[model samples]
Target: MDEELKKMLVKILENQEEFKAEIRKHTEAITSLDEKIMQRTEALFDGYKINSEKIDELTDKIDDLRFDVNNLGIKTLKSENKILELDRRLAK
Candidate 1:
């Protein structure tokens, strides 16, 4: 009966050690996962910042194009008026 009790006690201690080891492994895994999550979050924010800058640049370019088009329209109107005046002079 004594030997049987000793064997049971030893088995319980071995199981306790295995449980501790498993808990350590799980803790390490959680820590690693947390680090990875932080890295990915930082990367996502960086991408967003880059995209926002690009959008602002594109908007500025569009504004420049609009200004050029407006200037061209005004020049065209002036040229038409000059041509009409020349036609009137020729008629006289």
Candidate 2:
């Protein structure tokens, strides 16, 4: 009976060791997965930042174009007035 008990205890100890090893493997896998997720998240944020900067640059360019168009309109109106004045003087 004592021998049987001893054999059972040995079996339990072997099972415990296997369980510990499996736990270690799972922990390592989780750690590796977490690292990969962090790397991907950082990369995604970088892409977002770059896209945001480009959008801002495009918006500034659009504003500049609007300003230039407004200036052109003003110049065109002035030229029209000058041409009308010239026509009136010629009529005299």
Candidate 3:
């Protein structure tokens, strides 16, 4: 082969090596990014689990409050009836 052709072939081989190295670097970077994304997704799911538990706790507390309010209403009605009975006796 001529000197010029040999030099051209050497340059082409160098370019191919450089391109292959760049592709390998990019592949490693992509793999790292995927791992990071998976970690972030897991963290988000954990946060959601915690929030769901808190919501369930609050719901139970609200139910307890409702039960207490119903008991209070029954007690108030009994007291009012007693007062009415006393007023009727005094009027007689």
Candidate 4:
């Protein structure tokens, strides 16, 4: 082969090797970013689940408190009725 042509071929081969190396770096970076995104997504889901559980617990407590309040109201009404009955009997 002619010397000039040989040098050109050598340069082309070198350029190709450099391009391949650059592509490999980009692929590796993309893979790393994908992994990080997945991890972040998982963490967010876990946080959401914890928050949901807390909300459920709070709801249950509120329900229990409401039930107690209703019972207390019923008891108060009964006491008032008894007081009125006793007062009427004494007056008679």
Comparing 1 and 3 by TM-score, which wins?
A: 3
Cα error, residue 63 of model 4, in Å, equals 0.7
What is each predicted model's overall lDDT from 0 to 1?
A: 1.00, 1.00, 0.99, 0.99
Candidate that would win on TM-score: 2
Model 2 TM-score relative to the real fold? 0.82
lDDT tens string, model 4, 18-71?
A: 999999999999999999999999999999999999999999999999999999
- lDDT for model 4: 0.99
Model 2: weakest 10-residue lDDT segment is 1-10
**Deviation (Å) of 71 in candidate 4:** 0.8
Query: Please, what are the lDDT tens digits per residue for candidate 3 over residues 38-79?
Result: 999999999999999999999999999999999999999999
Question: Which runs of model 2 end up more than 4 angstroms from their true locations?
Answer: 1-5
Sorted by lDDT (best first), the order is: 2, 1, 4, 3
lDDT of 2 by residue, 1-92 (tens): 99999999999999999999999999999999999999999999999999999999999999999999999999999999999999999999
What lDDT tens digits, residue by residue, belong to model 1 across residues 45-79?
99999999999999999999999999999999999
Where does candidate 4 stray beyond 4 Å?
A: 1-12
Can you rank all candidates by TM-score, best first? 2, 4, 3, 1
What would the TM-score be for candidate 4 when compared with the true structure?
Answer: 0.80
Candidate 3 lDDT:
0.99
- Model 1 TM-score on a 0 to 1 scale: 0.74
Superposed on all Cα atoms, the candidates' RMSDs to the truth, in angstroms, are 2.3, 1.8, 2.1, 2.3
